[model samples]
Target: MSLPVHLVPALDGVVVGSTVTVEGDEAHHAVAVRRLRVGESVVLTDGAGTSVTAEVASTGKRVFTAVAADVRRVAAPAPAVVVVQALPKGDRGELAVEVLTEVGVARVVPWAAARSVAVWKGERAAKSLAKWRSTAREAAKQARRPWFPEVDELASTADVVAMLSTASLAVVLHEEASVPLASLALPADGPLVVVVGPEGGLTEEEVAAFTAAGASSVRLGAEVLRTSTAGVAAVAALLARTPRWG
Candidate 1:
């Protein structure tokens, strides 16, 4: 039978037959939120690809104990999918990060495109990036992801191009493009980076720069998608085509 899953980042390096105590946020979650009692079994994850099955030994207001019953190191999806998304205005960026995390993206790069409505600069940039990272962490836990995806700081179009150049395959989504995303043949291994432009889309010069860096322009479908939805759609399509999840 499948065991109950309870994601906790502090369970790293825990082995089967070892006894560990859950504290802080996790302790509160188990005792107050989940209302877990002694002798109940639950799965715990460290958000770094480590997972363990444990039985509750004791419960308290601030502390909880569990005896590890089994442990396994989960493998991440192959051909890591990285989403380079242009910053959208308002809460759109936050929504993008949360959905993409649930969609199993490996990394998120916040791009400051020329046509982007939202501009993250100075202290606002740092604070926004921190918020995105926190969102990613919480989303990963909610989705029960074995590994937490990273949320990078704001980057320029050129910086994004430089990073995508190192990947096995890099795709830039453009609605006006001739090539369809489904037509492209994905690599069996290595990394794939998908670049989604802002709501207004990329400038002619930005597209030229990415193409010059060996990034192929592809179209998702006939309908144009919002910046918040594009990355998640592309990731879902890629995952469906690849055997990474299997």
Candidate 2:
């Protein structure tokens, strides 16, 4: 049977027969909400490539214990892809993070691009970032990923430029770009970056800056996608050509 996966803070030095204790909100959800019971099988991951397959030993108000019978460590995905996503309006940003996590992107950087419809400031910025992180976390668990993707802090144009300068392959999804994303040769092992513009689209200045930082302006296809979806589409297309999918 496919065991239900849970997220733990860490699982270092875990081995067969080790008792693992899960606590706080994670335990609460599994014990109370999911009705996890003694002797039930589950897989627990640290989101850093370590997992323990264990049977629930006990449950409480906000805690649970499990006796591990198997442990696994996986290597992180190669050619880690980072998407610099322009913040979209409403809950679409969370949607973007959710799909990106499921699609196996390594990181999502929320960018406040020129002409972005939604703005993040003060308390809203913190709350919004938290929501994106939460979405990524849940999506990762649901996807059964050993290495969870990261949701980075809000990024400025200059920040994205700085990141692109060191990438092995960098591309920006633009409707009017001459080059197709599939036409480019990708790196086998290194950081790959894709920039997705906002609902209002990227300004010439923003495109120019990214290009100057070594990102290629590339098109996905003939049809234009929403800011919330363009990143995942571009990523899926790129992954199809990569060994990760092969």
Index of the highest-TM-score prediction: 2
Model 2, 1-246: lDDT tens per residue?
Answer: 578899999999999999999999999999889899999999999999998999999999999999999999999998799999999999999999999999999999999999999999999999999999999999999999999998899999999999999999999999989999999998877789999999999999999999999999999999999988999999999888889999
Question: In each prediction, how many residue pairs overlap at the backbone (N, C-alpha, C within less than 3 A)?
Answer: 0, 0
Top lDDT prediction, candidate number = 2
How many clashes does the backbone of model 2 have?
0
Q: For candidate 1, list the clashing residue pairs, or say none.
A: none
Model 2 misplacement above 4 A: none
Cα lDDT computed for each candidate against the true fold? 0.88, 0.94
Residue 224 shift from truth in candidate 2, angstroms: 0.2
